[model samples]
Target: MADIFSPSRLGGTSQAVALASACLSILLVLYLMFFADLYRRPDATESQVAQTLEGRPPLDIHIEMMSLDPIRQTVEARLNFPERRADAAQAGGARVRLSDGGFVRELHLPADRAAGATSVEFGLDGSISAYPFDVYRTDALIAAFAGEGAQEAPLAVQLTVWERLPAWEARVVSRPARPGEVGLPISIEARRPPAHVVFALIVYAVMAVIAVCGLAIGVLAACGVRKIEAAFASSLAGMLFAAPMLRNAMPGAPPLGVAADAYVFLWVQVALMIGLVLFICAWARRGSPP
Candidate 1:
């Protein structure tokens, strides 16, 4: 029995199996780290011009919302106009029309002016759509003009929009009202990944460490480096408790049935289980004391 489990007897097979398993595990980790964006969520921003006359002064409108707060449902929005049209906007008066009828306070634009840009900043408060797993979208309108016929000639409009957070993927759709239509329609879609991708990498690292340890134990057992006792101890320590504990260390991790659990942890645990069984069988086959 001892001769059967000897290192010379086992030869290259054990080393090859261990090498293959380690390589596969490493590839899996790299794929998940670089390309997996598992927690990405969708959002959007858009702009358009509505109802313009051929001879009217060209008006440029810029709108941007940033630093959105999901808990407070608030955001900082900025609107900019061409210096050429600032006077018209001020005289005509500019206003933001929110979909939810929320209040927006217009801020003073600085005296320092860019070559052609005039800007007004505002704070927007209301329901911001932030669903679990991170998805967001909003619809609103801006109208500028002080008195009558503001909707007609010289009342040019332009809008620019964007997501508050950096996105893994994004889409923008703009719909300008037809020749005689009333308002401009725009839509924005953006997807953001989990807040910190590094965290996911950390979790994978932990799993890799335990998995490697388990694989090493299997190789050692096959090479007869030690009796079955060492194999059983290593497998139990590396898989039964350590792997799960490491997985749970991720902050605010999804439940046990998430993709990582199913794909990564499940495979590692199965391999460890098989290693454990192999060690037990080897011990039994040797007719060693229970």
Candidate 2:
């Protein structure tokens, strides 16, 4: 047994060490992934505001976030106008207009059960300059209308303020109807999840490595510090195309020319292209080898 563990069989020991290291790395990665997922997971998938609306209601709006569209930059909201009370319209009105983000939406009081729920969309107004890190704000104002103009009413707002977006998380705030607004003004601020932000940073890091490699190759080849190979140009070309794919791989990547594109993806592409050109020039400059 001692002989089996002797220096003469160090290869086995090295292999065992390598295997253990690999296993340890995998375990660490899994642990991190799970921790990240748990940390980024929405505290509650659905924020049921059951108790929010108690009384003081002739009309109440159940505003549910249906989904978010990063591409179109819109938020889908489902308003359940349950047939409950129109007499609560305070000013003796059977109609209410929801003014949100400068758009006016009206739902008939004591909504017709046959008509079901009313759907409204609000534009996500924010800068997508820093994608994955971009934050958006959307709000709504409610008022009861006797005929045309909206009137203030004591509105009980029940907010179901949590929704798990594909990459973003919505944090909704229910602000009670102030002076002019009727029901309540719901303000939603959505941003990418922590895990997603971390993932995007990792992607940027990988892209940085690629860019550095390109710069190194280009500088080295231009300086004639290393023997240049024709294959290097092809490798650069491949990376030039593949780098965009890596950018697109982001959980919910925005269009080209985003902040990341300006900082990482675009630069990485430039690096590879420059490297390819340098390598090609060097390859051509060098005469036939012996």
Per-model TM values vs. the true structure: 0.45, 0.74
Off by over 4 Å in 1: 1-22, 25-55, 72-75, 86-133, 148-154, 161-172, 175-181, 193-290
Task: Summarize candidate 1's per-residue lDDT along 176-275 as a digit string, tens digits.
Answer: 5435434444544443455444566667667866666676666566667766664465545558577788777664444576556666788778767766
- The TM-score measured for candidate 2 stands at 0.74
Model 2 steric clash pairs: 58-88, 142-182
lDDT of 2 at 151: 52
Local distance difference test, candidate 2:
0.70
Clash number for model 2? 2
Cα lDDT, all candidates: 0.52, 0.70
Candidate 2 lDDT at 168 equals 64
| Candidate 1 C-alpha error for residue 141, in Å | 2.4
